[model samples]
Target: MIGREDWAATALAEIREMTTENFAAELESLEKRKRKKDIERRIIEGPKQPWRPTRHGPMREVILTVNKDWFSEDAAFFGDDQATRENEFGAHAVAWLKANFGDDVIHARADRDEAAYHIHAVIMPRATVEIAKPKAKVPTATATRRMLQPSIHPLIENYEAAQDSVGEWFGGLGLVRGERTAAAIREAREIGQTPPKRRYHAKTWKWRRQEELRLKADARALKDERLALDARVVKVQEREDEVETVFAVAEGVSSGAFVADGASGQPGLIEAPVAKETPPSSPTLDALRKRSPVGFARASGVFGRAWQRMFGQARVSAEAEAAAGVADAMQQVAEADELIAKASALLPQQTRTIIAKIRQTIPAIMRRLEQRVKPVLDDQKQDGKGPEKPRRE
Candidate 1:
């Protein structure tokens, strides 16, 4: 498909330039003879009605081009053996022309043209036919008119027949007519009709190339979608894992495996402890007020035992004063257990719409890691020590 700009570049690619008989001169000569006879007939008949329209004049131009990728990019004609394709395609086209137009096709010369290996020809059809012109007797007649009838090129005469002719020529080379033409022919076959072609096609390599590029872009878009889906799936799994770890720690605290330390002035993660046996699940305000220090130590967990070891006499009283209110401490643990349970049940989901807010943040995470490590690397360099070699992930 040469554009207007490309036409200049492709001028040399026009292979197998063919020139047929001078259609204008020949058609005029036939028209003149036909006119003389028409005039005589008109005089005798007194000018008949419903005459042929002016547009129904004899053919002067019937331009046709046979352009197919098979002749340009296929193995036999072009791709692997370009010379062979150009030669054979031109030869076939010439042979077809001769068959259809006879030796009037005297100037078919194969040229290595076309990134466009197609051939084109213009025809002017004029068939000599026999028409009766009354004479006194045939023996007495001197010479009769070689009547040239108003005939048409096969293309204009019967487009379908012309389609079959051109299609069959390349059929031997494993090429069919255009897709539309082929589909129409298939329908015609089913209906048991031939010729009077109802379909025609004008497709070019440019159209095909655009289709190819469009498919490639669609493929890339699908690939990107798949990658995004995989990333989301991985992030979901990570969220689930984090939720599971939190659930385990909270369950331990809720079941009394770990409890708030009575000895610590501040009850925190490090001061939390597990019960040695079946101690009170959590320290309650009533239990702390009613139970003695010894009973409280037994009810407490590892923290009670650690307090006993660290402060022999003082720990007995420290337990009651450590937490501001035993009920408040138990309430906090209960709230934590509830929070962990909610987080576990939600998994990748959460109270904060974690699932809805999922985003690809690997680059941000990596940048934060680098920010943390820069100071360490700087310290090492300041101490006259080379930074540690970075680990390859």
Candidate 2:
């Protein structure tokens, strides 16, 4: 999340020439324009085409609209806030489209300036047998009349009615109402009827444009901020690596220097000394003594081998534990990715909220990993020791 100061600074830096009043005006204008453009793009692009069966019939277009009334007081449902009502609404819409329309709904935004803060989505209405035949026979005509038809499903009817209701609610809040659908408004205009006054005035357009620039500047600043944060994270990771090295060294020191009986037995600090001078010979005694030295060497060798086996096992265990931890982290990353993808598929208002939530959680996760890795690294560093040298035969 960006602080207010940072956002203000970036805004001031990007559009220093414009007065605060003018800037605000321009910002609002840009947002409205942007929204309009986005809607147009979705409509033109159409819904993603799905693979159809050879025996299956042609598809039909279904256009759906929602009235502005279903939204919150501040038009917060339409605004670019994280966790806003609009996002939840969009999610619901998409879910409904996919489930009821068999995933063939093409989403389109109508270019109707008469209805500001409105949405126009297109769906392929071939899911049920009832709507399928009409849709298939005259797909375009069916789609065009779907909004005006009285026999339409109650769910869709309610959604359309909610727009005017929402506008009335907004009017109560001292905000202008945006009630008419683009299609309805256009028909009135074509017939020489005086349409309702636009909620957005010239000043509003100016403010919207300014806000767009501010948002763009803020986004650029955010990109730099993210890069810096990533660098810091990398540095912290390097420090953790150093700490792990320390931990390994400390562990080695704690385990002692050498093996005595075998690789698995107690560690030996130093090797036993070899006799330099030969004693006067008693054949039997000499033989036994000779055997003693050989037995001692063999026992020590066995102990060394056992120690190695135990050390190897410890290393493998450590590696496996580390791998498991990495896997867990990866799983979380995948979940975060999924959330991001879902957010992206939504409208701008909803997208921001999901992204914000994801952003909020990242730092905490990073801190937790750093804390866990630090101690092990510290131990490794403190235990620093070199390998032992081989003795002469």
Candidate 3:
């Protein structure tokens, strides 16, 4: 997927394309106006004399081509409106040129006629070496007096007449002059010097080391957290297994018979009910005898007569056999209940342990997240240190 930076770059490229197209159309219109004015001036003046074009015409004409690139779209500095943004950017570009090249910056103006808005500028000595040297400083008083002097020569009158004859279109796109100092110009040139390359190598190595450490820390933290969670899961599962085993045993034991009170010769025996509405049958003596042999023997002395009444014709030997089966079933039920109770008592402890483990893992999890994010931040910082690539067409 495309990232945020990639999207921003694409948007900038589109803006540059729009600006270039717009600037080209405006330049064409300016050229046409200049040509039309020249033709009209020649017709009125009649041939033979050397015709000097207006200052605006020569300056505007010299802006033969424009090279555009997207700058920042900082709304705080450029303002909100598109027109305002375009104008602010144009002004900044012009200022930058003037600071770098001094008086060689002859003209600069923004063109608005095309779909894409941009600035057009003219350089006096197009190449760097051809720039003129600064003139010697003169007294402020003398410069002020020269500016106030009135025109006297007929040629001066002719110049003013020519300027007045042209329409607004021929003059509106002229350049504005700006202040430039010798110190500022020197500083701008100094910026072109190359810095030592060794410094950058050392910085890159340091950044790489820090990134490696951050990655290791992140891995360690994640591993710890996963282990903690696994331990908790194991504990919970073990408790559940214990509980289920006890419950299964209890169910098996519940399906049996047992001896009860109220009997003379033989004790009364309770049996598992066959159906919800049906009355239970008396358990055999053999079943009771197997469950509690001593009790059965003791009861036989006093309840032998009652046993005959409750279970008529049931043999003592047969009842004793049944008692054995009931005793086994009762033992299974008792063991099941004991196992269930033991597991149930341990369940809360297991649950609490699991919760504690989760809590213990939280700090480590957060530390891992921080470690994972650190390298990305460091990479960004290193990227910021690298020299910016110039924007191109």
Candidate 4:
């Protein structure tokens, strides 16, 4: 009943009032057209109703509605000013109907005094429209074509197109498409709240609405999980950076290499900030210290293996963290554009771009780290030392 109107009453009252007011010129104009052949039958039988079977019943006027959701109070549909939005929507709707149905669109108007906004349009469904002039006949035609023959133009043929066109029109007014409005209604209902009355009677729309709401919820959950993963990746990167720093310092100290000028303003060995007692080397390794370079290589190889084991574990943990982040991001890719946009907005622009790149590059980073460590492990194996566990520092 929300969009329903008493069209029969309006039509009868308006027509009778015009006749009583002595609209002679209007009567003359109407008479210029063919009169109904069964006027006496119509009068006796009380005008053939829509529910009754009649030869011309299919040509009766169709009542169509065009409007947005009323109940949600969604700003996209209701907007800041209701009257202005309704008027604008009406103008667009009437124009669209005219464009589609041409002169067959008899009347279209908006009614504001209701729980929801909507437009009621009366469309004459007479599809065999008479043209003012006949279009040119093809040269191949042997006989003359009748100029007065009406062209068949079915209104129901373009029903789906018309539905899509209406959606596109409303979208220009900042309203989401019909499905979105339905989803909002469904969501409200799922949470034990009453939603606004539905415009359509079809149950499929309700199901679709619920599905959309679920998808929206899934998208939001995935976004939160992604953000949490991003934070984890950042922490992992920080820890990796710290490990690199420690490894670099250890390399400089062991090799007795020049520290950067930024540190000492000279190229010389830098003493450790706090000198610690060196742990006792393994007897076999200590004995090898006086041996040839090959023996020293074997002893150093043990320490190298220990460092590799430690950092290798760190690398695996970091990779696992990155992989989880990437998985969350990939799931987001399958979500609707609206959900994805909302999720993306939660992160900074640079961070979003970087995360995407990290997703793409993480596997390569892992492979490279593996390649760098593989040579040392291979050298240790080749040195013919039974795999001795390195002492922990």
Evaluated with lDDT, which candidate comes out highest?
A: 1
Candidate 4: residue 194 lDDT (0-100): 87
Query: What clash pairs does model 4 have?
Result: none
Q: Which tens-of-lDDT digit does each residue in 8-37 have in candidate 1? A: 233223211111122223334435446667
The backbone clash count of each candidate, in order, is 4, 50, 19, 0
For candidate 3, lDDT tens digit of each residue in 214-241?
9899999999999999998887665655
For candidate 3, the TM-score is: 0.23
Predicted structure with the largest TM-score when compared to the true one: 1
Model 4, range 69-161, lDDT digits (tens) per residue?
Answer: 543444565567564655666666677667766765555656554446666566544322221231335332122111111123344444445
**CA lDDT of each candidate?**
0.44, 0.41, 0.39, 0.43
Stretches of candidate 1 above 4 Å error? 1-56, 60-68, 72-82, 106-115, 130-132, 135-139, 146-156, 180-393
Of 1 and 2, the candidate ahead on lDDT is 1
Give lDDT: candidate 1, residue 49. Answer: 18
Candidate 3 wrongly placed segments (more than 4 Å):
1-204, 256-339, 345-393
Candidate 4 ranges beyond 4 A from true positions: 1-56, 59-83, 127-155, 180-393
TM-score for all models, in order of appearance: 0.30, 0.20, 0.23, 0.26
Task: Give Cα distance to truth, residue 330, candidate 4, Å.
Answer: 99
- Residue 11 in candidate 2 has what lDDT? 34
